[model samples]
Target: MSTSFAAESALASPADGTARTVIRSAADVSQLVNRGAAVGSDARIVIAIALGGVFLDAYDLGALAFGVKDIAREFSLTPAATGFVASAITFGAIIGAFLGGYLTDKIGRYRVFMADMFFFVVAAIACGLAPNAWVLGGARFVMGLGVGIDLPVAMAFLAEFSRLNGRGNKAARIAMWCPTWYAAISVSYLLVLALYALLPASHSSWLWRLTLGFGALPALVIIAIRSRYISESPVWAANQGDLRGAAQILKRSYGMDVEVDAAALRDTKAPVHKATWSNYGALLRGVYLRRTVLATVIAVASSFAYNAVAFGLPVIISSFLAQSMLTTILASLALNLCFAFVGGLIAVRAVPKVGAWKLTVLGYAFQLAALIGLAVVGRPAGGAQVALAIGFLAVFLLGQGFGPGSHSMTFASLSYPTSLRGVGVGFNQTLMRASSTVSLFLFPVLSAALGTKVFWIIAFAPLAGLVALLAIRWEPSGYDVDAEDFDAAKRT
Candidate 1:
């Protein structure tokens, strides 16, 4: 080390004589984190906790899918009113995503993360106890706030804490979101089924209440476990010019012990760009503009299609089949478990090898075929028609779970540098949630008017998505987000 840079130092030695590092700038902090990940640090605890937020997000969102009908029946709701109830959470999510993104960057990741869990707990209890449609809608909107805020922080934690080698690679870690989401959805289904089976026919009203409120259980559990393991992101610390803080976090959380020369940090200056609401404009002005567009299109297209069909699965099935409520819920539960769950698991395993680009294209192709089949078959009147509708539904879910479902969040989160990653994902999720709000509100109204022709209209969303993918052709899987930005800056 230079004598000028060695004025302040802490000593740590192993079998080797000495190993000394200097934390002079954000780059040094980045290197420390990257090296820790490369060596396969105990990051699983961090990742699992981060992903727990996603599981809760999906579970809370999908919990209402089966309960919507009962909610309508109990509250004497019109179709428009029911649509509002379904859309309320997404509407709140739009605002939450926008603000949460800016706040995650402004405040520390751990602060924002721990604060949001309280939203889940309170809102979930309110939703369960809602006596009227208005109250339920209000409670869901509040719960949506937690769901929306949790995502950007959770994703940032996952990416920053992750190692770039072996199974802990960027794509694989990001791809884990899909399976966890599906797992949450499947669990909701099973919970509903168990409640339905155990409850007496006269007490069927309590079923939906239990389902909606049950979301609090997991939220509380995650909060309890995460508190013990949470650590601030080293990159965020480095960005703030706290080299010692970053080094301590690495040693304490990641188990990477090293001596950081404080004198070196005093000698050099790293660029300081704190995230603010104004910085959001930067996404559209420079190199990030194209990436922003691609992420938006994919996220919106996926959200539109998924919300239209999946969120309203109960309503769609009820229209086609004149079965008992038990039968309807059972069939929907089976479809998600067998088809969607399996597809998501396969994508989690296959994405690193197949690449995000190819998997998404293939998934869209499957969606196109299934939708066209639905358009031709219409609603199932006979035995053959019934099988075709069910078969096509399976194909569509398979495609979604296999392709866009896994990569939409992955692309947005991995496309930007740490300075802007939270806002990048927050913005992406905002548009997606907006799309979700619109789709959920419009699906019932449109389906009621168009009948089976609605499938034809919904099919076009995935087609447009396919076109966007083929045109852009940027595959972010396993891309070095930090290095790429430095390279670009150097070129300019």
Candidate 2:
């Protein structure tokens, strides 16, 4: 029996009610909308607000560095305690990413996003007011939940909002999150510096409170803006068989003008039936199996490599420089600015052409060389060694900036269709966060035990990632995400 409204999703038209457009092939999907699909101004605003969720993640994550010394001093924490402070957030992030990705899809992107922000608000304040290291660690865990939950939602949001005529180059658009993290850390450094200059050392301990609390502020701002402007994903909406509702949202929330031709949307609906665990079994079968493998390797590799640097920057930098806490903060922020942020930008421009797998492969190769050079040439307290470290760092970052760092998220999002996107990205993120958290926990001890030799150990992840890239070689470059949904429909 056919659905009375036809077998179509939110992109299904009510224009005539009976004759709704249905997509059964790629030919039905338009790479560029010729008519009736107007890109809305509100779409851009929504992207910004969704990205605010990511920016909040970045802020909280970055603020930890600024807070660490004060947290250790205030609590007189042992190395284990200190490690707990860093790794706890990562643990929460892993869980949250797993849950958030699945739940965001089960619920809706905006609902999970809003729900996660509240975590940041409450957790940020708790971190600011924690009486002891344990309490502070717990608070960081909460903030990490908020951070983890938002990442997949934010990625979904960015792609959905930018869905205009082959602008599937949304990775280029959303890689802004990388730079945003850099900016967050930079601001945190400046904030810490300002407080240090103005407040006494006794008060500087509390400044960490302020720095940690600052993570919530961006979330609040984002929530405010998103509430006013954001629309749920039209594609997601269509999948839910809320075509009329989706269209109304596009017009009202996003300020989209022009009629939505259900025909153009690759009209499809989300399963009215609830998906079960066996649904996950489907991802490992047939064509999608390769996608699953490819994305998983990328996530795992990016998580290991990125965490080796992003989470352990202070420890790594401390090995080389001896000026001040502020100097350490500033130098770490500089790497984010030059490497992570610019890397994202360069990726947005070039990734579509190079494809995710190629970029990831190239990134691993460069990262491997850079890590080897750093390990060989690195010497503690030597000027030339420091110079070499910095040089290798730049070279390493360029690889990340161009490939794994930028393309990882891109691949994560595009690797699956909408019905499965949340789960796919979520699973990928969870694994990624797991690798990152494990490394976060182990890095300090390993670095202490092995020092520059740690780089040698870290190099293996990317090498494995490179191998995986070759094994599962699908590139999610040009298809309108809408088409993937249609492909899924045909499979049924």
Candidate 3:
């Protein structure tokens, strides 16, 4: 062996030398990992790569929403055909999320993140060149799969990497993704508007193609940067009997040069046993059971409700602008600018101090009020009421931006142990994406059937969520996030 390899091997924690696994039916996570939780440059590099994936997630998803109209015109789509094309990706996401979550738990995080990027690049290309509505729909579905798979992986990376760095401010980092998502949506909107201005009406198809093609750019950049910045999860590596690989990745990818305290790195205190299925069962028997349930609920609720609005934003705006095309376009653009960009940034700052749960409750409350106002104002009240309804809709969307709107995933992912971290997060992410699928179908039907009054009724969802939050106290604000699943790791 080379001198560097030998040296790294010597420094690796012996306890982590063997893969320490927690089987779904086992209770072995009694204590392990986390002798040192200080921030490493390698962890930061991982963060950079993960963030890149998320940026693409934001960009691709946002691009489609903004490009839908141009695509409709390009393909001469019927309303139903357009809706099918638009919602295709969400359906793909539901499948990708479930499979990704399962694979992430089984295969590991870095592998999945790397694989998903390829999906983004190839799928974006397909979408841009799609010859017909069916083909475009197929491409979008593939793109959705990429987005769905990436979400949990991104969350898992953030959680584990931040834990190593001893930063409980992980929520702050994840919450920032919300605004980045908004920024992505806004960029696509602006890009399409610019394309509209630059291109003649005869070649409008080019505009949509260009916008769709642009989605691939972030993923490509991310893949290249990732070679230098991405590292395997130290916690995950350690659990998988790759201590030396973990350290090497840490040094090279994150540029971490500090000497690892060997004695501290391998805790003699952590329980060790042959891995078994019962380790996972232990998660459900006690304190973990409640946590699992709470996080799952939040995940499901957030995915359903948030996407119901976000993915539906343009369509909703399109409906509102029925007669006046120009006004419709301008108003929709303004809403995105305010809600996705400005409002989301404000939310990022608010999360750390206000706490994710508090913001969630506050966000839900704002949405409820806004929904009621929208319903009442939208009644037989005519154009004046319609104006008020539009105004209130923006307010409600901003409220969504603040709480259950974007940062819900942050809370769910950060609430578990390193051993169960992948699975807990995977399950939550699966459900979250699944909820989005349900909402994608339900939102249009709900809006069309009940009209604006549908919102007032839907507002009750948050009230239920609010009660769950209060009853469960699934808060992650002050928790020593690193030490959380340490116990679970030992038993495993």
In candidate 1, stretches whose alpha carbon ends up further than 4 angstroms from where it belongs are 1-22, 35-42, 484-492
Descending-lDDT candidate ranking? 1, 2, 3
Candidate 1 TM-score versus the reference: 0.92
Give the distance in Å from residue 457's predicted Cα in candidate 3 to where it truly belongs. 3.1
Q: Return whichever of 2 and 3 wins on lDDT.
A: 2
Q: Output the better candidate (1/2) by TM-score.
A: 1
User: What is candidate 1's lDDT per residue for 1-492, written digit by digit as tens?
Assistant: 111323134355657756545556666666556655424554668788889989999999999877777999999999889988988888888888988898888887888889998889999999999989999999999989988898999888888887654455666677788888988988988898899899999999998899999989988997888756778888887776677787777766777664556564665555565788876887786668877888888889888988888887777777778787777778788888788878887887786677788888998899889989988998787988988898999999999888888888877888787888889989999999989888877787889899888989899889988999988887877666755433445212
- Can you write out model 3's per-residue Cα lDDT over 343-392, one digit (the tens) per residue? 56676676667777888878777777776776676553466766776787
lDDT for model 3 = 0.66
Q: Please report how far candidate 3 places residue 293 from its true position, in Å.
A: 2.8
- Identify the runs in model 3 with alpha carbons over 4 angstroms from their true place: 1-45, 66-83, 163-168, 253-285, 318-326, 379-387, 481-484, 489-492
Q: Give the number of the best model, judged by lDDT.
A: 1
Query: Per-residue CA lDDT of candidate 2, range 357-459, in tens?
Result: 6777888898888888878875656887787787787778778777787777777887666677777777888888888877777777788788788888888
